[model samples]
Target: MELYAKVLNYTMPVFLLLILVEQLAARRMGKQVNRSLDSVSSISSGMTNVIKDVLGLTISLLTYDWLVGHVAIFKINATWLTYAVTILVIDFKGYWVHRWEHRVNILWNRHVIHHSSEEFNLSCALRQTVSTVFDYFAFLLLPAAVLGVPVEVMAVVAPIHLFLQFWYHTRLIGKMGVLEKIIVTPSHHRVHHAINPIYMDRNFGQLLILWDKWFGTFQEELEEEPCVYGITRPARTWNPLKINFQHFWLLLRDAYHARSWKDKLRIWFMPTGWRPEDVKQRYPVYTIADLQAYAKYDPPGSSGFSIWAWTQLLVCYGLLIYLFAHLVTIGFSHAAVYGGFLVLSIYAFTELMDRNPHAWAFELVKATVGLGIIYWLGDWFGASQQYPWLTPLVGAYQVLSFFVSAYFSAAIRAGQPLPEAESVHQHGA
Candidate 1:
């Protein structure tokens, strides 16, 4: 976990820098690929995912270490040949895991957060899920274990494999000539994220395009059929926590209310977006039937609200970075408390961005809990000991945040429209 945190500390800044570059490139080209609220929500979702990972919040039904110990037919030496084979095996496992997540009903809930955004950009790639509490794909790596691949090799390559996918999640890049046929590129990934009927569930490869081509799921990007990014059923809220579990909650309700015992038992394993007939008929859920007629999930937000959202995000991010840097010293118990606070802070601010009717009250509760924690601990995980002035500065910032939240609440109460609700383009592709 400490090693993962160190790696994230370096890679996160590069990801943010590239996102800024994408935004600038979009501006120069007169296209808007990043919306302020959407981008904030995306980054917040990423922070939650990282916190979950750093805190070791997952249950593995089967252990890879156990598999490696028991399943090896021959031990392979660590060399260039071994590294090449490891990459290929990992990518093969990745392809199956990716495919299963899209094909299964319960599993899709774990991946829906990644596809929730209407805009496909670098920030959107960071919108990972926080609700995946179980690691069910351990069996997928049995082939690697059988090949006598070392766990150390996997530890080194897993993060690199995940990080490499980030560079392809942009609209600024087009198809590469030969690479398009061999590897996953920006164009292939764009098709994967699109909700267009022809492109849905296509291109499930991670590092290589060979798996998708062999499995008959590959689809080429066509100029006439531009991709429309987002899920068929929109997640209409800016709160990442809510978006993470929204589908699971629906499944739970459907299972409970299903008429037949078979329907109740099978609802979970059914295809993605399937519901019991009784549940579907009695309690209807909204879905996009006409792609051209739907609007993206953009709520109204004034400049004051935008500034308030950005400030809160930065504050939360700073707290996250501090916690991550000191995770070894802070220990898991205190880190969990700090992680909970950060989650609440993100939830409160994003609700305000969404203009929720009860947002101010949530903010008040969040601020009060924050102050109580500071007073109880007497400092921010021992920052006062090093910096001397850090605690007081944080206290002042907390008070200021409450006032800023209240001010926006009052402004929203008045009969005024949000300052910047209009889109750069009147319609989407």
Candidate 2:
């Protein structure tokens, strides 16, 4: 876990830099591919996912060591050829796992966060799930295990495979001529993220396009049919914690209200978005029926709110970096507490950005808790112990953040648009 944190500390900055480059390139091309709050929410979701992973929150149902021991059919020697084969096997398994998440009702919860963003961009790719507490796809890698692919090889390949998918999540790139036919490209992934009827649930492959093609899930980006991103049912909130389990909560509610015993039992395993007839009729969750009429979930906010959200995101990010740097010294309990604080901070600030009616109250509670923690610890979990100057710096930042949050909360309550907000509203009009 410590090793993973160290690696992420290095790679995350690179990912952020690429995202900035994509934003700049899109602006140059006269396209606004990112919304301020949405992009921040996406990155915040990524932070939660990384924290969950570094904390080792997931439990694997089956051990790969056991699989390699029991089912080895060929003891392939480690070579370049063996490494190439291992990657192919991993991609194949990824395809099935990705397909399963999209096709099954229950498993969709684990992946819904990724698709929650209304915009499809590099930032959206960072929107991963924290609700996936179990690693149930270990059996999917049985082919690799049986081939005598060492667990160490998989450990080396897995991060690379996931990171490789990041570059393709942009709109600045068009379809590559021959590469589009072989590997997953920007165009291919754009189709995957689309909610269009023709494109929905298609192109589930991560690295290679072969598995999607072979499995009949591939759909090409059509010139006639432009891709509309996001899920059919919109995740209306910017809070990643809420978005993470929104689908599962709905599923649970449906199961509880379901009349038939069979319906309750099968609802989870059934196709995505399938609900019991009785529950569907009674509860009636809103789903998009007309693609043309659907609007993106953008709440009205001033530039002030955007600045506030961005500032909070940066502070939360700094906290995460601090936690990662001191994961060993702080120990699990402190890390967990710090992680929880970061999640709450993200949730509170995002709620404000979304212009929620009760957001001020939440922000108040969050600020109080944050100040209390800082006062209690006297140094942001011992950062001052090493860099004594960080104590006053963090202290001032927290005090300033509270005032900013309070001011925004009052402005939101009063329904008085700041000058920057009024300018934004007029510009949009």
Best by lDDT: 1
Report clash pairs, candidate 1: 302-419
TM-score of the candidate numbered 1? 0.95
**Model 1 agreement with the true structure over 73-114: per-residue lDDT tens digits:** 878878787778878888998898888889888999999999
Model 1, global lDDT: 0.87
Off by over 4 Å in 2: 73-77, 418-429
Q: List model 2 lDDT by residue over 1-429, tens digit each.
A: 888898899899999999899899999999999999999999999999999999988888887888999999988777888789889988988999899999999999999999999998999999999999888888878888889998788788888888998999988899899999899999999999999999999999999998888989999999999889899889999999999999999999899899899998899999999998889889998888888899899887777567668878988888788889889999999888888888888888788777776776777777777778888987778887798887677667666666666666677788887436554334221
Candidate RMSDs in order: 4.2, 3.2
- In model 1, where is the ten-residue run with the lowest total lDDT? 420-429
TM-score of 2: 0.94
- In model 2, residue pairs whose N, Cα or C atoms come closer than 3 Å (at least 3 residues apart or on different chains), thus clashing, are none
